[model samples]
Target: MATRLELALLSARGVGKGIRLLEYVGLVIVLAATLLAGGHEVWRMFSSGKVGISDLLLLFMYLEMVSMVETYWRMGKLPVRMPLYIAMVGIARHLMADSSYHDPWLMIAGAGAIVLLAVGVFIVRYGHLRFPYTQASEEATDRE
Candidate 1:
């Protein structure tokens, strides 16, 4: 026997809980996948008995992915720069892996992409420093 407002609030709370549960499930999947991929990469390197710069870069990207997931899980929100950092590493890995076969223009474009991602990371860092989100505000947003 709840009022319409009370019913709406209850529904909202339920939805919020559902969303949070889904987020956790997604995070777990991402973490597992990243770890599996990293392990596979390590096994390949060990079996081959050779490690190249590109392989190392790929491992670094995987590490960054894991770190990004951990940061998001701990902070309840993700920084905008984590994906940019991952993208930069991915592009660098691609460039290193395919430098010999890729056309010069494609290589230049990939390098440009890395630079743009770096700029994005810089801008996000500056924004965080210059106009940081207050904890109370963040908490309020998280509650919504």
Candidate 2:
């Protein structure tokens, strides 16, 4: 027979396992979707016989998504900058594909957003380098 504390710990462990399982399932779904989208994009380009810059950028975004998922799956952690990089790519793609040249303010806003995201990525990388996380904190962060 286990003590109350032991039972509680066991329950917590089970919950943790369930959460991790869900995480894995979610990752798989995301990976599958990304791959499917990328393949469709490639097929579209081949069928049309024209690969535009926007199409390439869209593919690149898919690749980044795949890489982000892979990194998280393998490392059990995610760098904060990965999503920022993806966002920057997405914004650039949008700006290129649907250039709002007539609306100079909108174009400026999109460019500003990319610049802000880049700055965020730089700050995160710099922080990780200058004030690296300790083993314990990193593990804590992974748990969260």
Candidate 3:
């Protein structure tokens, strides 16, 4: 029975390792694709003479995506505030690009929302850095 339990444990560890390997490979593939797409977009922007605020904002979004991928690759984890920061930037860019198309009140509201999101992202990032979760032996064993 003890041998059987050991075998099962070993099998589980093997499966976990395999899964982690696959995740790493997938992340690499995704990062490559994002880079290609961003490059293509930048080329198109340069070739076209009608560059606008929205186009610049899209580039910024692509940059954020790359940054997020790099952060994950380096730390083996994703930061929670990255997407929020991206969203805030996206909204602000949209407002800037389409200022004449929208009503004044709507534009003001959108800008206000972006400010609120930026504040929230700041708080979350600060808290995460200040109160990081440490992996002690008991917590590690509990996870196992």
Candidate 4:
């Protein structure tokens, strides 16, 4: 039984190592892709001579995505609000860029959705700051 437990522990450690390796590889790939995409967008912005607020907003979204990836790589976790904030920016950009092409009602609905998502992100961020969670290792011991 002890040998079996040892083997299981070894397997778990091996799997954890494998996962960490894979995560690092994935992070590298994502970072490279993000840089390439950002460069392309900047080139387009300079060449087109038609950059607008929406273009800037899209760039901000890309920046946020890269930041989120870096944050996860550094901390092994991502803030839940990051992606939500990105999504809100993306939706706002889409609406601003193509508002005239869609029905007014649809535009209103999309804007409303963006507002709701932004509010949710704000609430989550506030809650997290106000009431941070205890680390799992810290929780293992009771305070005197």
Report the CA-based lDDT of candidate 4 relative to the real structure.
0.86
Q: For model 2, what is the error of residue 125's alpha carbon versus the real structure, in angstroms, after optimal superposition?
A: 0.7
Ranking by lDDT: 1, 2, 4, 3
lDDT of 2 by residue, 82-133 (tens): 8898899888888887856438898899999999999998899899899988
Report the Cα lDDT for candidate 1.
0.90
Better candidate by TM-score, 3 or 4: 4
Q: What lDDT score goes with residue 74 in model 1?
A: 92
lDDT of 3 by residue, 1-144 (tens): 469889998999899889879978988888888789889888898898678778878888888988998888888778789989899888888787875639988898888888898889889989978987777954885457
Q: Candidate 4, which segments miss by more than 4 Å at Cα?
A: 99-102, 137-144
Q: Each prediction's Cα lDDT score?
A: 0.90, 0.90, 0.84, 0.86
Who wins the TM-score comparison? 2
Q: What is the per-residue lDDT of model 4 for residues 1-144, given as tens digits with 9 covering 90 to 100?
A: 469889998998898889889998998898888889888999999999888998899889889988998999998777899989998988888888885738888898888998899899889989989987778644663221
Q: In angstroms, what RMSD does candidate 2 have relative to the true structure?
A: 1.5
By TM-score rank, best first, the candidates go 2, 1, 4, 3
Model 3 lDDT, residue 59, Cα: 83
Model 3: CA > 4 A from native: 98-101, 137-144
Report how far off residue 86 is in candidate 4 (Å). 0.5
Whole-model lDDT, model 2: 0.90
Stretches off by above 4 angstroms in model 1 are: 99-102
Question: Judged by lDDT relative to the true structure, which candidate is superior, 1 or 3?
Answer: 1
